[model samples]
Target: MKIRAYRSYFIQELESIFGEDEAESFFYLILEEKHQLKRIDLALQIDLTFSENEIKVWNVILEQLKQEIPVQYILGNTSFYGLDFEVNKNVLIPRPETEELVDWIIKSNTKDSFSKNIKILDIGTGSGCIAISLAKNVANAQVFAIDVAENALATAEKNAQNNKVEVAFWNRNILETYDLEEQFDIIVSNPPYVRNLEKEEIKKNVLDNEPHLALFVEDNDALIFYKKIAELAQKNLSENGQLYFEINQYLGKEMIGLLEKMNFKNIELRKDIYGNDRMIFANR
Candidate 1:
């Protein structure tokens, strides 16, 4: 059948579940991925057709979409910080808010400003988005990442190689590690910060499909990863080093207080483009 007619049916089928705008976006993303057709191509050439086999594939994807699986997972890859990354059930899909976190780090430190290669460590480095982005953008950055899950680390290592960035991967649980390999010029994390009580706010696409191990923490200890990473940062960050986090927006005040108590200096809590307090930077 002609692509436009199928597109109409696709949008109609998903509009109630994802809303019209989102459903349309998903259609175009799949179009580009599967058929190499952009939205403008569809507009200019409305007579594109999918073969029987292609339509069967689209039907499988369509059903997955109806079940509210993330389109990135359906596609098996995603873009972050202008780089492509492989993603799956093992890693949290990188978010735009995280791109902002990465931009902040890249802007603050550049190779031209440093006399030597700066070392960075990313704790709970799901998908290695933060570390790899830094290694790619920040010149002279020797990046390292740590994650508890071996499979997640494997995915992240694959991302690093695909991005052509040299990042050392460590398969260690940050919460259990007292000593870092060495002092780092910067330490960053987007650790699991969502509390159990807040699960209701998560979209079904995320709650149902994304890895819970990379998403949730007990309500009573939502800051557990932060506390552990902070303690390690205190011990392992070089003089005048920086620490960054993609934090729980609701706990900005609490995060600031935690850094203050840890005696970190020049604490700055930043909001993402949506104006939620979503990231923080502190100095040693």
Candidate 2:
């Protein structure tokens, strides 16, 4: 089939689910990932045709998209903080909001100009997006990441290697232990902050495909991970060390209150691109 003809059918099928613009975007994304052809390349060769084998592959992906499977998972990799990360059912796909959180940490560290080696830890580091981004962007940063799921840690380790950054990966449940042996200049987490009550607000694709262990909390104790990480940071952070979180938008005030109760200083809550309360920074 001619490429443009196939593109038209693909977008029409997905438009109801993802909207016209996004459906078009998905076509181009798949073209690049599956065929190494960009939009411009497709445009220049409007008469380009797909072989029967290629059509079969495209049909399979289209069926999955109709079920609301995330495009990132369908592709098996995604761009985060300008680096490629392998993702699967075991790990949550990295989000743009989390990239903003990583950018904040990198900016703060660069501005401080710490001459000594900087130690950093990422709690619940699914896919190691934040940890690897920091290690890649910040000079003199020694990064370590922890996750309870051994499978997630395995993916994260591969991500670190793919990004050409060294990050220590540990498989440990943060809720059950506080056994980090070294002090860190910065500690960060983008933990499970979505309360069970908020599940309805989540997109169908995420609810259906992403790992719940990395995305949710009990509604009654929405701050569980935040509180635990804060307690561990209090003991493990060097004097005036920084702590950061990519937080649930609905719980900003509660997050601030939690940090205040924990006696953290210089607390700041920042909005993401959508102007929602999305990240928090505090000093230990």
Q: Relative to the true structure, how large is the alpha-carbon lDDT of every model?
A: 0.93, 0.94
Alpha-carbon RMSD, each predicted model: 0.8, 1.0
**Per-model TM values vs. the true structure:** 0.98, 0.98
Report the lDDT tens digits of candidate 2 across residue range 163-240.
999999988999998757889999999999998888999999999999999999999999999999999999999999
lDDT of 1 by residue, 33-125 (tens): 888899999899988899999999999999999998899999999999899999999999999999999999999996687888889999889
How high is the lDDT of residue 38 in model 2?
A: 96
State the weakest 10-residue window (summed lDDT) of model 1: 109-118
Top candidate (lDDT): 2
lDDT of the structure predicted as candidate 2: 0.94
Off by over 4 Å in 1: none
Q: Give the Cα error of residue 279 in candidate 2, in Å.
A: 0.4
Q: Which ten residues in a row have the lowest lDDT in candidate 2?
A: 108-117
